[model samples]
Target: MSELILGIESSCDETGVALVRTREAPGQVPELLAHALHSQIEMHQAYGGVVPELASRDHIRRVLPLTDAVLREAGVALDAVDVVAYTRGPGLAGALLVGAGVASAMAAALDRPTLGVHHLEGHLLSPFLSADPPQFPFVALLVSGGHTQLMRVDGVGRYALLGETIDDAAGEAFDKSAKLLGLGYPGGPALSRLAGEGDARAFKLPRPLLHSGDLDFSFAGLKTAVLTQAQRLGQALPERRADLAASTQAAIVEVLVKKTLAALAATGLQRVVVAGGVGANRLLREQLDAACAQRGVRVHYPELHLCTDNGAMIAMAAAMRLQGGLEQPRRDYAFDVKPRWSLEEISASIP
Candidate 1:
């Protein structure tokens, strides 16, 4: 039987809702029907960063409306949804509660079951929603918000961690480096945009643990290096901002590309999947694509829009998990959120 899954994602500053319909074939990916998102970027922009309390309140206002929009777009009534899924953890506690509360309440009111999804797992399996999806038995480079990890994925719900950031994740490195250059909030994208205008080789920055002999990553040192360089630039920092941005981006991308290549070499996997927000980076994609092409390896990425947190990935993950039999939705209506759940824990507990 085909199941219709309604996914709610309010793990952070964005409120997203999506509907997905499962395929009849066991291993086939689910189809994304409709998705809607409301970003708190504008609201948070005044503060220069996400404020948890305000984020939670805004999510409360947006989740239901976004859900309605998704249902309308999908041409399905709320009652038609077979299951309710939500991002259960690894986000701001209040933000997570809004999604969890709404999803559970809706499920209970409909007398349906609910599934709690891991935030990172939503990212890991996101590429399945892309036009060109990747097959299993591939290495995954997950670089989102505060988490950076490399994993081997054999199938849905089957994951093995290869390595991860010991200190700041790649995204943090980008944001922190951007701040050092006086770029505003959500610095990663800002920095990347400015990078296009300057020479990447204009300034030399540290590439931490580039040859660490393991897939584990460290960006704290690199971030500090950017700070030192920016401080040294002093009054010259204004004219050299673009150059610094480019340099920082280059350092981060180089480490990511080299580490990913190393992961492929270690696993002997011919395919690679890059998910999470960093996967949308133009330079990272270009570099990784060229390197993988030369090696005769295929690389897959989530659609640029799907690279960030969204309902589509959440819905897609829920549908895949249901189809894989890795989890069964619950009907008790009692729900909880994990502010710091690890993807490894999900893999460990499932099998």
Candidate 2:
């Protein structure tokens, strides 16, 4: 029988819970049974951004209910779970603790072991559970809410950071630029939607470090350019906002696509997997698809719904790690959550 793994994720504004079944074969990708998520976007809408304490409180309110919902949807009992996993780090301290504490407590109650999963790793490996999963040894472009990185992924647990944003992340640039245009909270998607109606070339925006002779990215300058342009428009800003939005999306996408291709060229890898929330951008997918197709590179992405933080990715990651012998679920139950652990902190070579 496959091992039933229950995963929890409360790294940010969403509380996610999922069930995954790890096949007995060590190399097989786990199968997702069911998943549930509660987003705090509406709760934070009034603030124009997430408040950490509020997010933590919401997670506390939602995690268990979501877990119960997942288990019910999966038709699995708590006693059936063999391992429990939760996002351990690289997020708000309070949120991380909420998930870790809940997972550990649940695991203890069931006499099951707990595995602490890394948040970025969940995003990176998420494509494996996609309809069309990419093989190992691919270049990965990870663009999430707070991070934008290019990495060489040899296999599960083997990740080499190729390049990353020096200042603001790609998502941050989207949100900040949207805020400049008076787009409401959770700005990225709103800005992207507005951009579709305008001409991308109407405004000339800076593509910072596009040709910096390396893969490192810089979006801070681009944000500054957007701000300066918005200020210059004065009273006419609203009329030209869509064009500016289009231009802004274009600049970020150009830098991201170019950098990703550069990483692929440098790695000499033909497969590329893009994950995280920004991967859902229609423009990005279209442009990257065209570019990668021209280069004979196979591109993959998590399902649009899975692009955001979710328990399925966390569960899949934990199952994969277990399959790879990368980490072990522990019965000790005494756990500490890390708010700033790096993806590179894990050892790639198995002991």
Candidate 3:
């Protein structure tokens, strides 16, 4: 039987809603009908970062409208939704609550069921939305918000953590380093843009844990190195900012690519799935493609737009999980969000 899933994502500074439909075949991937997202970047720019309270408020204002837009785009009515899915954790409490509350309320009104999705899992499985979806038994490099992890994935709800960041994550390295160079809000993208104009060899930045003989990452040190270099440039900082950005990006990319290859070697997996917001980095993608191609390995990624947190991934994850019988939806409207849940916990929770 086919089922329509309505997904809501409000884990951070974005309000996203998407509609997905389960395929008739048991093992087939679900179809993403439509998705809508409203980013709070512009709203939070003045603050240089997200204001939890403001993000929560904006979610409240955008969730319904976005949901409506998704439904309209999917050419479906609210009542036609068979299951309501939403991001449940590892995010701001207020932001998470907005999505959870909305999803639970909608499910309750329709007297259907609700499924709470792990934010990281949504990102991890996002590549399934792409044209070339990865098969099971792949190495997954997750580089989102404040997390950086390598996991061995065998199937839905089957995951083993191989290595992770001991301190700051890859995304943090980009944002923090960008801030040190006086780049405004949403530093990662800004830094990458400026990097295109400068020489990556103009400056030498540290690639922390690049030779630790393990996949564990430590970008906090890299961030510190960037700060030190910025301080040294003092008066010349503005003019040399692009070079610094390029160098910083190069260092981070090298570390990520090396660690990812190490992970693949450790697991002996021929395929890798790169997901999460930082997975959208152009340099990262280019380097990974080059590295993987040389080793006769396959690399997969979520569609550019789906690389970040979005309702499409949440819906896709929920649909896949349900299809795999890894989770059971509940009509019990009582719902809660996990602002600190880990993907390991999710793997362990499966019966």
Candidate 4:
């Protein structure tokens, strides 16, 4: 019989739940039986970013229904879940607690074990949920609102940090640039859309630290460059705004692509996986795809919807760990949240 795992994620504004079944095949990926996500984008839209207290409150209201929805959609009873997995750290403490508390309570009632998944690990392993997943030991570029990192992922529970941002993350740079150009909240996607219609050469934004000869990224300066250019425009004309957006996007994409290619060469890894929110950038994807094509390297990304926070990835990670015997069932509810958890600190064994 296959083991069934229930994954819960409420680390931020989204409340997600998923049920996955372990694959019996030696190398086959796990099966996602049912996946559900409740995004609080609308609720947080007025606030420009996630409001921690509001996010925590909403998760409390949505988690139970989301869990029930997933179980029903999967045609499985709560008692059928063999293991429960919850995201435990690197997020708002209040938001993290809602999912952790609920998951532990559910596991206790079901008499099953539970696992605490690292948020970034879920994002890094997300591409595996697809049909043509990359093999182990590849470079992972995690570009999100809170983090920008280059990591070497050897296998489950095996990750080495190559480099990371020293200041603003790539996603923050996007949003900040967009705000300067009069674009609203969640600026990355909005700016990318406008950029699609603008001239990439009309403006020349600086590609910060593109030739620094180091893996560390610095987007804070790049954002300042955008601000300076936007200030010169005075009235923020439509054409000027679009051009600024396009130029900024191009600059960011160039830096990311060049750095990733360099990382690939340094690590001798031909496979690259892009994870996190900014991984959804159209230009970034195109540039990486084109660059990798020329070098005969493969690039992978999460299904667009899964590019953001969701339970499917967390559940999948849990399933893999359990199948590999790296994690065992837990009958106790002693897990704590890590607001600033580091992926490198994760040991092979479940805590």
TM-score per candidate: 0.99, 0.98, 0.99, 0.97
Worst 10 contiguous positions by lDDT, candidate 1: 342-351
Clashing pairs in 2: none
Q: lDDT-based ranking, best first?
A: 1, 3, 2, 4
**Candidate no. 1 TM-score:** 0.99
Q: In order, what lDDT does every prediction score?
A: 0.94, 0.93, 0.93, 0.89
Give lDDT tens digits, candidate 3, residues 143-164: 9768999999999999999999
lDDT of 4 at 105: 91
Worst 10 residues of 3 by lDDT: 203-212
Predict model 1's lDDT versus the native: 0.94
**Per-residue lDDT for 28-110 in model 2, tens only?**
78899999989999999999999999999999999988988999999988899999999998899999999999999999999
Name the lDDT value of residue 162 in candidate 3. Answer: 93
**Model 3: pairs clashing at backbone N, Cα or C within 3 Å:** none
